[model samples]
Target: MDEQSTRFETNAGVVAQIRQLPVGVVLASGPFNYPLNECYTTFIPALITGNTVIVRIPRNGAAPHFPTLELFKKHFPSGSISILSGSGREIMTPLMEDGRIDFLAFIGRSSSANALVKYHPAVHRLHTILQMDAKDCAIVLKDSDVEFAAAQCVTGAFSFNGQRCTALKMIWVHESIAPQFVQKVCEIVDAFKVGMPWEEGVQITPVCESGKPAELKDLLEDAIKHGAHILNAQGGRFSKSLASPTVIGPISQHAKLWTHEQFGPIMPITSFSDLSEPLDWLAQNHFGLQSAVFGYDPQELATVVDTMAFQVGRVNVNAPDKRGPDTLPFGGKKDSGMGVMNAKEAVREFTLETVIATTVNDPRNVKALQGLEGVSRVVKGTAGIKSE
Candidate 1:
């Protein structure tokens, strides 16, 4: 923990937020996609900042009664963290209506987020953070390593059954290199193994959802009707609780795949003649969670990336997109989400700043202002003010 302080003089004395205090009680809701990660991203930091929490988690993602929950019980006093489970917003409704919940950190769909804001106008007062759906995209330049980029996109699109919020939902391949890149992507994705859960030879597993396969199929059919081509070997099946990875290519901009957030193993590939076209299309979309691009144009890429920096939360170059390390702040933009998350961001978001001040002939005579442990950087004036 770093000891941070600010020195300034006023009629009364010097003033600064000596400490970042915990905001208050939090109502944290976990997403069904990344349970372990989303949980820690919200609850842990709030707890660290001295705020109690009420967590409402989706049943499918919750790690049952294990260290995730048990460890919290073992260390913290009772009631510091409480877990509530129920379908949809059944459990969330009453909690949101409760006046005692001081804040909310949620990673879920926009419908739920809308409900939270609508039902609880005071939600903003809680300093809430909501992570909504994302229609993330990947751009492949003509000059890129086509095969390598294809492989990375395959993994980014189908890994985790494409349930990840930051998963590659669409690929905008350069028109000149589109055919070859699609061939490589098709070859790799075609060989991907899909089977029942816990199947040894299967590389792709079932979705966390039970009925999402039908939704994905409907979207796929719509894309095809709208001039999209299917690229996979077409050797897969979809059940009520499971769906095989589906790759559709040469999707038209008019297709639903271009607009909707398909949180399944349905990858849509589009071709663009100009690099800036896809980048601009992504910016125009409602979601701005994260994006990736593969290219060898060092100077152009840098300039493009600099422009993209403020448009999205994070940008991955030649690499697959991820939520990022616990140390680096991660969040969404526009309709995707607001506020930020990360151990460091969490500490800041969960705490409120209050100033401390005092007058002293020698600044060292007053105790140095202490800020959040790790994030603080302070200077000690033990010998008093230095001569200019």
Candidate 2:
């Protein structure tokens, strides 16, 4: 935390503010995809800021409760933290409506975020932060090492069974080698192990079916029915412990799957005639959480870095999907989310600012007759007491 704050001061000017008053409460809500992380991200920072925290675990019960509680209890005072399991939004609403909670942070979807904004009490002192939905992309180039790109893209798209908001959902490939790239990527994906998390050799595990996988499959099926290609992961079997990671190819720019955040092991690939095609595709999308690029061209990398549509928490260059460190702020750009999470951003979100000014020297003790040196002397300059 100290190292992060030090970097923040050099980059974002956080140390000056923290040196000032820093006591507040932070209310954190956990997201189902990364339950343990979401809970820890908010809870630790709030506790560090000398503020109490109340965390609500997701309704589906996918939290690392004992480990998290144990870690906090070791360092924090009794009653400084409370992890309540069950009922996410229902439990959160009361805290948002209360002034006792100085800061409120949530990690979920856009719909849930809108609900909080609508239901929250109109108190100016209460600060709210959201790390919600995102539909991320993987831009594949023509000159890229086909096999390496496929492996990287597979890991990026299905490592957490595509449950991460930062996972690659849409893949944009250059039309010059789109067919070859698709074939190679599909072949790699087909061989990925999908089974129990504790299995000897498994790369992807099933998302606890709180209904997300079924909905995502329906979307993929709809895409296929309407002219897209579906490349089923060949070696995987669908069971309670494993999810069938499917790849939908040659997707259109306007497909619903391109715009929505599919929280499952499903990959959708679209071909672009030129670089602008993918950049334009990004411009129209609603969510921007993270993006990965598999290319050798420096120009393309520069273009993505400079584009407004590339706005996201982290940008992966030729690497698989992974948020770098707790030091970097993680969140989305568009309807994907607002505010930030983890590292310095989370700490800033948990605290409030207050400015104080004071005036000394009694009015009666002042010399009223002093000239311009000590006090103001009015001249009859038509504009009344216009002092020099």
Candidate 3:
């Protein structure tokens, strides 16, 4: 609702006003993981920028949104916000094919995003903001503190059962310190408390997606068959929806885990003889969301960081890869995703810049433009601007 306008006189004796305008109706869909937060990250920006939004409740976490229906009805005008439930294909296909959606804000897998985008009748006319798959990696250098690196890696890889898009899916440790780092990681994994989400000290909870445990088990077995060893004693233990954190080390490049975005509680580790091994792997990898490098030498870390910046969207020197703070740019590259999210970026993504120009000599045109500005200011005062 905040009206942004810039008025300036050009050398051509013309006065122009540049403003932001909504991109029309937006169809927003978020993944089951971080359902509420991710969904609002998309639709809230669109709504604030004057676009009507149609939100598709994710199949796994639909119940959490039921409580927000009353809030939406109270704040927005009728038909401004609509929530759709049921099978995604059944509801989304018609919306996309109808060619009414101007913006598509989706956070999920690449395959699902591709299918939904292809369903749109006029692809070129549709603007999309997609946050998809990521196989983020972490590299621990030989001179780094093994204990601290292991702790950071554990938190990054196993948080939310490794379902996060920014989670460290693969880890590369220098050959000299690989064994020590892997041992420390295994110890931390064993200490994690797995139980119901409501438990006071629970660190690992049941996965939301159905059959995810089985899928994770299959991935673990595949890595083992391809020459990786399960380092943790209780790793891969599964009962129904719960799967204990698993650590598989020295994973073969031929293993499925090497290329797959194992969005589960499975930590895959590998060792590198030289820095080139990890850097080359990153170059050849399809995903480019984020990467982490840990080392004591400033120059060594800087070299890796510079190389990783091109290969990924963000690089963490000694911390875990994360989306963070809500103010920073959150996005990926290549097969990982398209477009960016966060406060300012999301607003830009959901709106378009529009310019209105008039000849300075045209008295009538100037008067009309002034009147329109007055009306816009009045409207903004009455509705109050909303921002993220």
Which candidate number would show the highest TM-score if scored against the true structure? 3
- Summarize candidate 2's per-residue lDDT along 110-224 as a digit string, tens digits: 8987777666666566677777777888888887777788778878888778888778888888888777787887888887776677998887777886566568766876777
Q: Which stretches of candidate 3 lie over 4 Å from their true place?
A: 1-9, 371-388
Error of 2 at 29 (Å): 0.7
lDDT of 3 by residue, 1-388 (tens): 2445444334466766566788999999988898789988879989998899999978888888989999989988999999997777898889999999999999888998899999998999999999889999999999999999999999999998899999999999999999899899999999999899999999899998778998898988899899989999889799999999999977898899998999998999999998999999899899899999999798889889999999898999899999878889999998888998998888888988776666656667656656665666422221221111
Taking all chains together, the TM-score of candidate 1 against the true structure is 0.88
Ranking by lDDT: 3, 1, 2
lDDT of each: 0.78, 0.69, 0.87
Error of 1 at 14 (Å): 2.9
Q: Give the distance in Å from residue 57's predicted Cα in candidate 3 to where it truly belongs.
A: 1.2
Q: Please identify model 1 stretches exceeding 4 Å from their true place.
A: 5-12, 15-17, 358-388
| Alpha-carbon RMSD, candidate 3 | 4.3
Give model 3's TM-score versus the native structure: 0.94
Could you tell me every candidate's TM-score relative to the true structure?
0.88, 0.82, 0.94
Q: What 10-residue stretch in candidate 2 is worst by lDDT?
A: 378-387
